[model samples]
Target: MQEYADPVIDWLDGGRGYFAKKLYRESCALQPNGSYTKDLSLVEEDLSRVCFMDNSPVSYNWNKANALPIEGWTSDPNDEALLDALPILDSLRFTSDVRKVLGIRGF
Candidate 1:
């Protein structure tokens, strides 16, 4: 938790978590009767503003991989406890998916 403080500090001090308020404004501008041109411009403006202030640019590379060995392990799961927890984790995932399908509010 101590490691998480700097970003929190940066956020509260003159940062664009402040400008996230503009997301609502920009969203409103996209309404049917709003200026279509200005709406689009505000959308892009908010997006760039967010990316700039947050330093998370639009581009990213994603990847997937198969197996990886742990420091002193021979195979996946590594121990009995991880193997035991797998089914519980899978059940929680299924429950989450079911909640999503049912339009559960706080998911």
Candidate 2:
């Protein structure tokens, strides 16, 4: 994690772990067409078991079926996007194939 993520993290319980290494990847599709996305393949994790959440839908361009959309955070005290996503994520924990679930949800 970078210095930008430090302050907010210090407020949550065990927040540092949430920002642990391998939690994210760099942009792989930065082009004139404006698809600034991250390729999940770079993470080397099993796609079947992986579900990605991002505020920007384009980040899911490469593997959209596995995408989980969340609202962008702006340090708003009233933000509840993460809370809204918890149930879906909780169900994902027991999924054998994340794509199937996300696909059914129309992601």
Candidate 3:
């Protein structure tokens, strides 16, 4: 049997277990009716910083692959796991509760 490391498991092991919160915060920040401006790049940069804070290698790989590090998982176009995660990925958006939990300055 071919062994494929589960991305989710790898992500958790990478010490970015709270990536979901980051993702939600970014989503909220980028929302049209949200507090922050609609600059996706700024949010992406922050998200990248979160990954870099956890593991340099993962951050390098993520940037090299030109993939968005969403919810601790690299959104690689060639990765089947990423493709499978797309559906539920949208559900990771930020809500008022999530903003409060993350202590996001802006709603």
Best by TM-score: 2
What lDDT tens digits, residue by residue, belong to model 1 across residues 16-84? 443333322223323354321123234343222221111111111010011111122233444554344
Residue 103 error for model 2, in Å? 2.1
Show where candidate 2 strays beyond 4 Å.
1-27
Which ten contiguous residues of candidate 2 have the minimum total lDDT? 18-27
RMSD to true structure for each model, in Å = 18.8, 3.6, 15.1
User: What's each prediction's clash count?
Assistant: 0, 0, 0
Clashing pairs in 3: none
- CA lDDT of each prediction against the hidden true structure: 0.28, 0.69, 0.34
Least accurate stretch of 10 residues (summed lDDT) in model 3? Answer: 48-57
| Candidate 3 lDDT (Cα, 0 to 1) | 0.34
**35 Cα displacement, candidate 2 (Å):** 3.7
lDDT of 3 by residue, 1-107 (tens): 00222454455457855443332223323334333322323335543232221122233332332233333335455656454544433333533222232232221
The sequence of per-residue lDDT tens digits that candidate 2 reaches over residues 1-107 is: 23433454454325545422243334366758866777787664678877777777877788898899877788799998877877887787688988887888777
Model 3 spans > 4 angstroms off? 1-41, 44-57, 60-79, 94-107
Which candidate order results from sorting by TM-score in descending order? 2, 3, 1
